[model samples]
Target: MFVSKLFGGRASDTFITRNSGLISHLIPGDQVLADRGFTITDVLPPGVTLAIPAFTRGCKELPEHEVTRTRRLANVRIHVERAIRRLKGFKILSNIIPGRIQHVDDIVTICAGLCNLQPQLIREEIEGKASDLDEDEHIDEQQEGDEYSWDMAEDIEGNHLF
Candidate 1:
């Protein structure tokens, strides 16, 4: 199920994430997959993790493990981007109706429902191929076991650490 909230265009992603009540629904150990723009690590409830692509900072290149993790994250993030694209496809969402501003939440919920009624976003065959790649890479058991963790931390300077 999809949960959504309507916020003004000027609202920051971190603000919306913290105030939208979405965090309340998450439990300890829940991992939130998000884009680099979502810098709400400090606001996340205790034990809840956030995962985003690794930043190279001033380094010449990211380590091999970071590269692999980033590739996996990007592959999964593609589906999320596609879902947003589908949501935007609705003409009602293209232009705001001043008169229906109060009902924007309902409209978004209905549109999300309609999108859910469509075919599965990722097919089983494609998923199998991804697993095949992982096997070919000979991923370690420890990394495989922590696949769902996606632990991310922020340093004292607010820079994200993988």
Candidate 2:
């Protein structure tokens, strides 16, 4: 799943996603779960869906269904974040990659492979139960008022910048 090259730290998420070659590997009916920062709907192939949290632009609060979807998405993202944390456990990845390194991608791929070979992060029983949890059940223990920043850039049309 490592489809993109090692990009600089300043690269935008959408820009990296566009050049990642990840879309080519996906087929129709596939859904790409992403963070709100990635506004890649325009570049997605036909029949592919992008799932991100709903934006509460003009509303005081998100609708019930949107809240449910956002919670579920956040629950799923926890595992993804854990996997990334495991990948970062490697000493080489913990530090900033030197600019002179020409084969950084290969090294990262090898490290990822090594991480994959380790024990599964989530046990099957727990994973199954996690999926079965009710939509209203709060998985994340984040405090109230501690929300992600909504100060995102927008295009001339008032749409979120990609």
Candidate 2 residue lDDT tens string, 1-162: 243678888988888888878767665655677767778889887877777778898899999977876776676556565556667778886664678388778778887787666665544443443436665664453322232111221211222221
lDDT of 1 at 47: 76
Candidate 1 C-alpha lDDT tens digits along 61-160: 9999778777766655555555666678789999978999898999999988877676655543443333244623432222211222222222212223
Best by lDDT: 1
Which 10 consecutive residues of model 1 have the lowest summed lDDT?
143-152
> What do the candidate models score in CA lDDT, each in turn?
0.62, 0.60
User: Candidate 1 regions off by >4 Å?
Assistant: 125-132, 135-162
lDDT of 2 at 50: 76
CA lDDT for candidate 1? 0.62
As a TM-score, model 1 comes out at: 0.72
